[model samples]
Target chain A: MMTLSSLPAVSQAQAPGLPGRAGLGLKHEHFIEVLETSPDIGFFEVHAENYMVAGGPFHHYLGLIREQYPLSLHGVGLSIGGEGRLDRAHLARLSTLIERYQPHSFSEHLAWSSHGPVFLNDLLPLAYDSATLQRVCEHIDQVQSTLKRPMLLENPSTYLQFQRSTLDETDFISEIIRRTGCGLLLDVNNVYVSCINHQRDPQSYLDALPLHAVSEIHLAGFAEDTDSLGDRLLIDDHGAPIDNAVWQLYEKVLAQVGPVPTLIERDNQLPAFSVLLAEAQQAERYLAQVSP
Target chain B: MSLQDDFAAALLAPEQACPDGLFSINGADPASRFAVYRNNVHSSLINALAAAYPVTLQLVGEAFFRAMASLYVQAHPPTSPVMSEYGGALAEFIQGFEPAQSVPYLADIARLERLRVRAYHAADCQALDQQAVLLALQGQADLGTLRLQLQPSLATLNSPYAVVAVWAVHQTEGGLATLNPWHPQGALVLRQGLEVKVFAIDPGSVAFINSLAHGNALGTAVEHALEASTEFDLHQCLTLLISHNTLTHLHLEQKVSP
Candidate 1:
């Protein structure tokens, strides 16, 4: 079991989270529990937006606790793959947060959340056409230039397919990386979830991805239910413990992708810190066995 | 419309249904696939709002927050991908909002919560010391015509309700539902080190801070403080602001000679 005391010493100037270990998304409910008990998770991940408030207890705890653990600012907003021009105010806010925490790795979804004045809070799907691809790449370029750091773009979990999408999802991601030199935050659960939703093979989806471009792997629990047609449906709920299928998927990906930073994401119904640490330890075990 | 834009519109406003080309199922209706994106958009947004205003959720309960968030999502959806900055205007909406009228303090809570969010994401700056500020103001004897600077992370809000106590209670371990209407309170929100904190300010501190926030200099702020209460201690307010890192940059508004 990797312990906090034994983990790499995190410097104020260093990127958050020690390399080649598994982490858990730190929810507000588990703040003191994780801090007081000091769980042996590899590191902790937080939504960049959660701590984006001014002087409050959230920052108070994060500031103190972040001193001991490597932290990553996983952003769900900043829709990097959106069609509209990047919101400067949002970028400025994100810049302030990045400077304050100096997280290990900054990441956002490869989907748009905004349309003009209305922001659809979900990671809405984007067409995988060449024109859309160029727009996303340009947006990523703008973000990287402004932040002066490469941001990892996570593959989104999709429910619907677009007719105008001229490019495959894998090819779109590959082209994005080739153009912008950005890293990939590949969520394995998302692959399985999307695969089941789209009636595709998860293995084929994962195999098609540019594994070398991946800087991180995300594993989380999904709620399994049956569609009206009795087909298996997987919803990436992140509210439960890691499911066996997702774990097995993680192991398979680990075997191929080798050791990358893996995060166990549990956003809702967050359990005790030990519960997440145990989950992280499970991923750590897989990371150790991977051919790093 | 571009495919992405069409998809975005369809997801946000399910009434603006997608054409059959977006997804073609062999045996299913189009709404089945559209429902997935629709559900995703609603649930994800509800979750985001819950995360943003946990206290508000706690105040109204999950079911109510979800219903309210769903309505909020329809009326005012997120304009930015950054979820933290998404619900800044929620408090304002809750003010004119009818369903939440019984909980009059809810809007103030949302306002305070938004302030807390803004302070956390505000720019980073080093606070100036009292000595420097005092020296800067040494030559200016005109007390009423002075202006001062507040920190980027500092936000001040006044409320007839005991919003500070209300926020404080929800923050504490056993204080979730303990609401006391007797004590009127105000809040001074700021980020200290890496954390955002909210301090309950008395009437004098509120007046002094508001004056400074209005670009009034130290002398004018002190004057405002004195008018509120003869016992208003400017030094105490100054010390508190300095200690909390509420003042980051110092500036003087040029005096307009009459």
Candidate 2:
């Protein structure tokens, strides 16, 4: 349940997992397990905020671990689509982390996590209007300029719809990409969750997205819970393993987009490290089918 | 108001409904959908607090702690994206909470737990070497005027109730209830390497550490302790602080390090 430290270095020659497309979310639970097994995975991704500390086991472990595999730092705190301006201090901390480790790719959700000082700690959805689109693009421009790196903005899973929305979700993401020169992290589970919640066809939603701009794919488990009216609400808790429907949706995207860095994220009720690797292996299997 | 601001306000205040111009185009109720955001926000925060203060939750139990945390979150939503800094006001919230008044020591325990959380995430620092400390103080005639640079992660909290004893027993092999008499206690929280630990400290030592924590020199802090308690032991207290690696580096208030 903790990040065990032991990563020294691997051979300069690229390992089987390096430069590959299938990866597992590098959680603390699997740190020791990952080190011991050195599983044949493409890359490992981590939430940037968790490693934002100055120096400790995180940096020590991550330093050696990065040598063995490709790393992608996914951020949950950027709140790019928020109403307020981007937090400069938070941005600086992120930049520091980027400079230190220099992960292969960096990504954040197109959702707001803060209103002024209070951080809601969830990927709250935004109104897909002209104003929000412009604001998000501006924020992206600043982040890219500050970090000196192109970021992949992940699409958020929405449980509710905005009453005064003008732009379609796919159109909004496409516009953000076009305006900011940013890439997309296509989260198949989020597409499944949002589409099922709002009763849109997941295929249509996937088709509308700018698949060419996608650099990474996120597949996670969603909890099928009901809302107040008893209608199903697919909560993206990232608690369980990726489900069958989501896997099929993933395959559909892979069929079109080919292969990218794919991650399996399980944040709560974490199973054994082997279980996650098995899931990651399955994602590899799919990528192999798409490419081979 | 902007749609997001209004939406954020509604989520913060449970009584408030979905913001105006909010809808579910696919026929799902907007209110229900809004509740999803609300639940995500609250449950995530509650989980953060629980993770930071597991001992406190154990002391108060889950159901009661959840209810208390719900009220705490509503009263004080997080002001920053840093989850580590999210629940700083929880100890004070517990102090003001009427239902938790029976376990008056609960707030102090929570405060101790928060200190541990801060220590765990504090910058990794190298502790002061014992030989270096001795060499620095060897020729110094005015030792009392010497200020100490304690580890940034080192902290001391004095409570009217035995907080350290309570925190320790909960972490023991078999968790036992605190049967000790209701006496005042002091705790020294420090990070040894990456792991944060708590030590039960004598009242005089706590006074000395508190003085140093406030930027007082060695002499002044010792005098402050002596005034507070005539039985204050300076040599023993310094030994305690040194042994625990609480004092990382030493400094002279008026001049540079020796």
Candidate 3:
């Protein structure tokens, strides 16, 4: 058999242009369709953990995709918000992937998904205390220095809150950006979900955000599961189309911060490629109206 | 305990109260708010396990698999964020699970599935240079010191039960043939290009492959294979491994100083 190693390395050396106004989370199911059509979009975002493999179909398809569209490496596993020290092995893998992909924007959540050896496989919430804040800042600093590039921290849609948190979620994110000099990935869906779950105002929450630091934005669908009191609890499941409320919130964010590299994320029950592209086109239309 | 620890534990178990210093806004119930996380954590992990071990889930039926997965998540949460790399211990957990004691081959099936997932993600490497191997085998090229390297994705599943047949039958929609649990079966998991495949082999091939996998010289591995089975065919096994591209690199013996 021919050597498989040489097939991908040659092309991975060249860098694609950075993403523009709108992109979508590239799923494996849509790889073939994407290659066939080559739809119009700013870029495609892939989970850094999925492509952590040595080499194979993942890289093969990614190589083909990277040749055409700009790429963004979005990480869900870093657990930057945790009190535990960052996993050096995981960080090493991330560094290698960044060097290989050279994605336009490298972003991870402002949430903890791991504690010790146990990986919960979810973007978990954290208490925004001074100690936690310091821990998060140190982790971000390490990640930025190790990656040799400024990273963007995505705000997560949390279900619970900690009374110990003296800082509001926005202030807490702002403080991290201030200390680490990292950019922000403002997810409109997360803002709407966190506010609805906490009975806080979404507009006011967006108003307090460090939008200037926001280099990217994410818009995804959320699930509406009821709480014990029969109240709606928004879960950021990313299984459906962007809701009308979230779209309006995206409009508000665009009105405030103008255009940013926004992504339409749909992880589960993925629709046809055309569906995602249309949503991305919608984002482009909204972004077009802005005076950036 | 710290708030993070309590919060982590509470997500797994609902009987445990919300973490210290947790409160709901607008007088909403904190437990109700916290339940969202409990739902997300358990369901997402359960879904991931279900996706990885669909055959196991299929064999035991969805209802039982869900319960087993729920219990497994509580007993052992993931230590790494690679969801595909998670659930390495599910097969072990299933062996002790009370409700799953009936299907004795269930754990092995889970193991077979796990190995396939690992092979799918394992590192890529080039296959053995067949021309050099042919030349070395044809000549009297110090067989005692000839070393072989298999692909990193290669694995062997040695089981007392007919696991390969049991797994194969489950792959299609058809009649459920009787699988003799006492029948010994050995299967070699191979990866070609991008996909992984499992092939049932005889006891001798398993013995020879096991020896080679542990870095034994071809001559030593052949001896072990002969000991395992009188009719061991070293040439045929070599041909099979080379054909399947399981053996990636070969190292012939060097000339020793007189």
| Alpha-carbon shift of residue B236 in model 2 (angstroms) | 2.5
Model 3 agreement with the true structure over A108-219: per-residue lDDT tens digits = 9989887767777778778887888999999998998998888888888987778788888888988898888887788999999899988889999988877776677899
> Model 1 misses residue A262 by how many Å?
2.1
Worst 10 residues of 2 chain A by lDDT: A1-10
Ten residues in a row with the worst lDDT in model 3 chain B? B175-184
TM-score of the candidate numbered 3? 0.92
- Predicted complex 3: CAPRI docking category: medium
lDDT of 2 at A64: 77
lDDT of each: 0.77, 0.83, 0.83
Considering summed lDDT, which 10 consecutive residues are worst modelled in model 1 chain B?
Answer: B24-33
What is the CAPRI rating of model 1's predicted complex?
acceptable
Winner of 1 and 3 under TM-score: 3
Per-residue lDDT for A234-262 in model 1, tens only? Answer: 67778888878788888898787677778
List of clashing residue pairs for candidate 3? A117-B79, A118-B78, A118-B79, A119-B78, A119-B79, B128-B248
